[model samples]
Target: MNEVQTIDELVISFENHLRSLQRSRFTIRQYWQTWKPLKIFISANNIEFFDITVGKQFIKSKLGAYEYANLNQMQRRLVNTVDALSVFQQTGKIHFGSAPLRRNPPKVFTGEIGILMEGYINFRKTTFGLAKSTANNNIRSLYTLFLFLEDKGVQKIDDISEVYILFFIKNLNPSTLSVNHSTLGVVKGFLKYAYEEKVFSTDWSKIIQRTNYKGQPKLPSFFSTDEIKSILNSIDRSNSSGKRDYAMILLAIKLGMRVSDIAGLKFEDIDWDKHVLTFTQFKTKKSITLPLLPEIGNAIIDYLKYARAVSDESHCFLQQLSPYKKVTAEDVSRVARFYIHRSGISLKERKHGAHALRHSFASELLGNKTSLPVISEALGHGHTSSTMFYLRIDINQLRQCALDVSLVPSTFYQQKGGFVS
Candidate 1:
């Protein structure tokens, strides 16, 4: 909270804040060691106030590279430390334990079309009751559409036409059918909104049709049980952060809980007496319960007993450092990817995300001959139809539909080779 303007002074203040938060001495030392080099770099470069530009320069000078993906674990941690310092100085906000990992460019639109974009976003939120994350996604899609229109010399929603829509569709050049399907849904959704408001002369919504997800649904990435075991085993249970992450990963792998639901879990959601974990699903808003196996229960209790930050937060988990509060879904994914990488599993062909674990959990159930309705309920999906996609990866069941060529030879093969009976 100190309004320290200079990088040197701010670093001292930030360190003091961490100490007050009672962050482990080891973590504090790691941060201190990282900041020491940054201080020397800034001092040598004759820099006064610290910023990301200076931080990047320092990182490049030290590591001889600027690309984040190219950095090793220790080097990335160095970047995170420097980035955390930059954020602390600029925003006066300590992001608690870890530094900010992802930063997206600000979406900018400056015209009447921009105004309508804002109006449409607000309308969707108020009228349709869209969640914040959903609204943000819609805004990103609409931003792309409006950016194209603005380039085409359009200024209002009234200017949106079938021609403009066609150009937009053609310009997308999406890599996959699923991406194309989602892009069209955004266009159609916006068109419907514009037509209902009488902003567009033609009902362009009719001109565009979205693919039926039910007919051609996107297949989710799933992992084998052995792969999941590897990911879980990668976690070091001695640290507080590791304990929290271990528990969170179990929720995703064993319970099929979404990132949002895991991050938003409250203490009240746990029924210790009944050994049940109950919470409302964020995407569907339906309350459901899962049995709290001893392994998961033990993990959570270990975190609570020795790892959970001291705070009045109602959420089951908290940021391990000062200003302890709920974490974002992105934070959960980062943790997931970190361990997934450490586990050394070859997931380059598949998505390395927590959702894959959710898919894996569903597939495991399918392999166990769990019924579709039961899996649907267990997954907190609104319908069994939504859970049917798991069948694609149910190789055991799919084999039942295949004919054994060895057991019965076809007539064509008999004619071609003169097969003996």
Candidate 2:
């Protein structure tokens, strides 16, 4: 094979490799599209051979040039593209790691403590069958605890004391209620495991005070009917991107599918003759079959027939650009936000993303006098309580359910005169 001399050649080679791997057209297109900026930057700066160092410098230079929303997206895309390129240059094949951890592992998780943490993570996965995200979270919490233990001059797992655990809790950021709760729960579990395994003679977990962080439930954000209509109408359906986005928004509002489910949708998931969409939900891992609304079906058909890029990948949705691949949940959110921004709809403290569409779907059903259980089923929620949050936004229904306080008679004593019943 000829030596890959330019970024264009490298991209072409990578695109072919992705195609061979049956990667979605959208994925290939997005990867290539993101690489275009780096290609340009390299040409302008006379930089040859793209690597981590050059990628960082390029990112640093372009930090403030883009809008806040696009800046993070661009940075992530660029970093991922550069990393892929670096790997491909070394192996002459496309290989990437799993999703990056939300927070970097603390320094203390490097030595003996690290080994213990790894064992705990494996135990969480194999023994308890916890999800990958949950296991990673537990690992993160343990890492934090280990960092605290290190600071206290405590060397091993056996040396852990209640005072050190209490000190860790005391030093936790007060504003981070969610983090503190998760960390404390994970620490408790760790202590229990250590005790059972005979690593610690005493189980200190039982003594660690629980962080009382039962925050008041806030109302979920949702768009009104008019707002949803306005946002949907804002999409310029004349273009390929418009058609794809319109279909995605319709799925969110009509079917109440999560962004991940939408992004992961495949051709086989849709039953055209039966007029049903069936797929496993991303988060809940439950198979759900939703009636395919005629409008949604038609929108999808229009995109698939005319707008969708040609690719062997089975995913229904693909990026319109070159090297097309399956869209991500983040991509779905960006599409929603793009239209919401253009439509001039004020989210008003509600989440301003595709999830908001789901919220709106439940709210609409509730407004139409739909039962909570039915609404929960439609939303693919495992429990009705998961759907209860929507009730907080249903003002009319709440009013109807409100109890008459005046019916309860209260005996009172007159202030200046005499006792009155």
Candidate 3:
């Protein structure tokens, strides 16, 4: 899209969109007629782009003291048009004839600080090619600093310094070193952007740098062999949903497929002849093929034959209920959680998601003295380091690592009240 768009251009595009939606000729004409007032307003003000802020002002000027839901037909038409244009610009989607959308534009910024915040977010997205979610995370980290500057009467970005930076860092709630490091990186990057743009004079990016975090990650959750069996048994398997879920659980426990990979399973990803399954791993984007265990293949066959939803979607798993949508990664995880709870397993301090099943699968292999490299390959881990996370759950291996007591002083063990005297 062009960096700058005129009002007329947007309206023309919106008209094409309305036709694509298969709106009736008369309905499209009605929407087109409503666009005139907005066009006139944008022209009079010389707006280069029709943003939500301008849209709100247009509604106030045209409607002139009107209730939201209580608007007359003429007022409603104009408000909906503005709402549609606003939605089109922000999301590239039409929301025609929706008052609630016009009333509530997402997160409007009013002051200089808010304006700067908006710029930072836009720059981060455009320059770094960050996804919307990643950009939101950067905002989450930097918003506190923005507020701190405001509270300190530091209106100009020029006032930011080592002292203010230090103070802001001090007030943050203590978190893991990793979390703290991520937050610091965000602050430093924002400062770099500000300096390069001449919004702030100081080059404060040098104030913070990334460092390796040495702490061990907490042990991952896994079920015992019995607990895994119990979870599998909890499913009734009498109905379609039960049958569908049983197949899903087997994929996790038996193959150690990630929830995403399992939910995204396609019929073509399986080889009925060779007894193998192949699919691209979602997180790593690397393709992996695993031997399709006869039990897992059979379970999948049972689901496809009896219980699977009749969806046109190529994905193998689908919701049991109407609409019969393809199951999402969340859907699969929720299935795991549901049966884990029903199995009457103690979930205290243990993750009960599909991922825990993956952990259990690895731990089971480790218990059987499966080599780490072999287990790593079965888990489709790109590196053994990733597979090593499951090693902490092997209590016997950890016991072997326990320090030998041969070097300890004999006096330390014999010490008592009599020895002290």
Candidate 4:
């Protein structure tokens, strides 16, 4: 019999309706944000009772300022809000949807794309044992494809036909440049995962074909020997900050440790008498050991003796500035990038963060004839195949491994034919 008291109260009621419908947190949040602008318009006009004529006037006025995209989104929110209000009015909770308009059919999208992404996350967790960050990236890749499909007027899970998927992959226009083979792989992988999980009716993956437009595999960029030396030389070791940066770079390049793992290392992880630095990799969750190279040992000793911030925490790396908390992955990468610029190198080339140094280290070792298994162990790669990507970079090693062939017979045959002259 009584209407909602205030705008805030009305919003709360709407939010509660959404929650009761079992909508996702993301959807509920979007709905709330979308409805907020309308509330603002209502309050501004002093037309407060969920009136349709006033709503239409407010939307018409927006046509002057709001672009097509904004208008479409607002319309969608309006539709959902009106629908919810109608439900509430039916229950005698509020007078709602007094203004009636023909509603458009919900657009079709390959919404099963979400199911595929969830499948990838589950697969990475149960099968590959990937770290949270890596698993997250695979999900993001699949999500991006759905966004592309949504832009192309395909919306809803059931709308994703084989033709829809193939056209999306192979026949992308220049403006829709985001869709590529890597994303195609994501779509492909998601479909396979769905089939395996029995989420698809007919193993939709079998019909999904690849266009085979492979991207050029790039060598991971790293500081060359001279660049590394230049960076080290640029540091004023007398300063505490310089000493810590020097030490961090040494660990990054020499030990091939990821910034995340390096930042998480504790003072206790180092064994002085045993001459080893032992720590579990944060990304891989595997324990690894490095023979404390005298240079690395000296760097750590210098940093701890002078540069390291004294703290109750035992992490080897600590924030240089305030709080004296643990260094983050971004912090480690930032320092490395700063030194790179200070070294007077062009930032124009593919800029490398701290992990590039890890890639650099792997490359260096593989170039020096270290076996793939050894490099994998050093890099804390759970699989040797993962480390095998470095082979693509070590061309010299590949050349040297070419079986020795005598050129003498060929030369003599050429001379015997007298063609050499």
Q: What is the C-alpha lDDT of each candidate?
A: 0.78, 0.76, 0.77, 0.68
TM-score of each: 0.65, 0.67, 0.59, 0.61
> How well is each residue in 1-421 modelled by candidate 1, as lDDT tens digits?
4254677788887888788888898989999899888888889989987777787778757753123443457877887888787787777667645454434346775787777667878888889778776887777777778767876888876677789988887776343445457657876887788778887778888987655654344566788988999999999999999999999999999898899999998899999999999988888778999999898999999999999988888998787777987877888988898999999999766888888888888888877777667788898987665676544535566443333466554765556456544
Candidate 1 vs candidate 4: the lDDT winner is 1
In candidate 4, position 190 carries an lDDT of: 78
lDDT of 2: 0.76
* Stretches > 4 Å off in candidate 2: 1-108, 127-133, 389-421
Q: What is the number of residue pairs that collide in model 4?
A: 6
Candidate RMSDs in Å, in order, are 12.0, 12.5, 14.6, 13.4
Residue 322 in model 4: lDDT? 75
Per-residue C-alpha lDDT of model 2 across residues 290-364, encoded as one tens digit per residue:
999999999999998989999998998998777999998889999988998899887667788887888889888
Q: What TM-score quantifies how close candidate 2 is to the native fold? A: 0.67
Q: Write the per-residue lDDT of candidate 4 for residues 18-52, one digit (tens) a residue.
A: 67867699977776765677778878888756644
- Steric collisions counted per model: 0, 12, 0, 6
Better of 2 and 3 by lDDT: 3
